[model samples]
Target: MNLRKATLTDYGVPPDDIPALQSHFRHLDENDKYNLLQVSIKYAPGIETQIYDSIVNCIGYRTMERFRDMPVSENDFYGYKRKTMAEYYHLAKLTGRL
Candidate 1:
């Protein structure tokens, strides 16, 4: 299994830390989740692909349920076009994510 790591400079979060994000998201209120999604609606700059890879690495460290069952609602990132964040969100939504 390959491990990738990178800082989402825009959000100040390492994309490889999905587990922590999941745990924290679970404890947050609806508004807080929305705010977090809003804040994470973008990536740093030129590392979108690395961010995606890191997210995949992060997901590999956990069960599929953990990624799929994030506290985010279906409409959370509805219209956001953030590449890195989008990669993570869409991967979580994809059927049979590995």
Candidate 2:
């Protein structure tokens, strides 16, 4: 499935999050990115494990690629907006769930 379709069906994310999600998926197509940020806000140990597993298996080397490309500082405004979604992913891991 296309990114938009996969994102919608698998994660149930709203249309607003799509652009950001697509940016992240361009770098790492891992499901955890969607599940953690798009789904629940609460954290759980099981979710942490799931995120790790998904990241390790699906993201693989692409994680670095995506992270490196991620926006930092003001010059990259669009990138910064995209980074917000990344932040959600980070929060998911940090909180050990989501």
Candidate 3:
């Protein structure tokens, strides 16, 4: 799935998130980055919610509030949310669920 930059942007990921997305990319090898991006755009905005819930393993009213970039303390994973998103994509692949 060779995704265009515009494709990801069109998926509703805010432009401000590019830096965070790049940070996640920094942690991945080229192939893994491509795979995760493919899964991500395949699922689009909905995947944002799914990944947030999965990453936090929430069992309550945790909602997807944590997906945004907030103060470091308020953010889950302490500014590593994008990396966590990537992890969720990887997990989805392992389970063949996404």
Candidate 4:
């Protein structure tokens, strides 16, 4: 398996670590997810492809049940739908839909 390392440049931020972004997102309130998504989409632009790949690399493939389940009822800030933001990114890559 190949591993992909992410940096602030990947997310259009000045910081040098993607793990810190992951940790922050993990603990952030659910409502903040959209705001975070918007910022990511705006600043990172094409970073979605890489973000999807990185999430899959980190979490492995999500179970079908977990993948399809909707954890967030809100329309995606990125206009994609899935169990969670990570799952959206993962599925997008898996299906070549991103």
lDDT of candidates 1 onward, in order:
0.37, 0.41, 0.44, 0.38
Give the root-mean-square deviation of each candidate in angstroms.
13.8, 13.5, 13.5, 12.9
Where's the lowest-lDDT run of ten residues in candidate 2?
71-80
Give candidate 2's error at residue 77 in angstroms: 34
Candidate 2 lDDT tens digits, 1-98 = 33222333243445665666555544644565565444322332223433333333454323534544422222332222223344555555466543
Best by lDDT: 3
Clashing pairs in 2: none
Residue 41, model 3, lDDT: 48
Q: After superposition, how far is residue 40 of candidate 3 from its true place, in Å?
A: 8.3
Model 4 clash number: 0
Greater lDDT among 3 and 4 belongs to 3
Q: lDDT tens string, model 4, 66-92?
A: 554434222231232122343433433
- Candidate 1 steric clashes: 0
TM-score of 3: 0.27
Order the numbered candidates by TM-score, best leading: 4, 3, 1, 2
Model 3's C-alpha root-mean-square deviation from the true structure amounts to 13.5
As for TM-score, the candidate ahead, 1 or 2, is 1
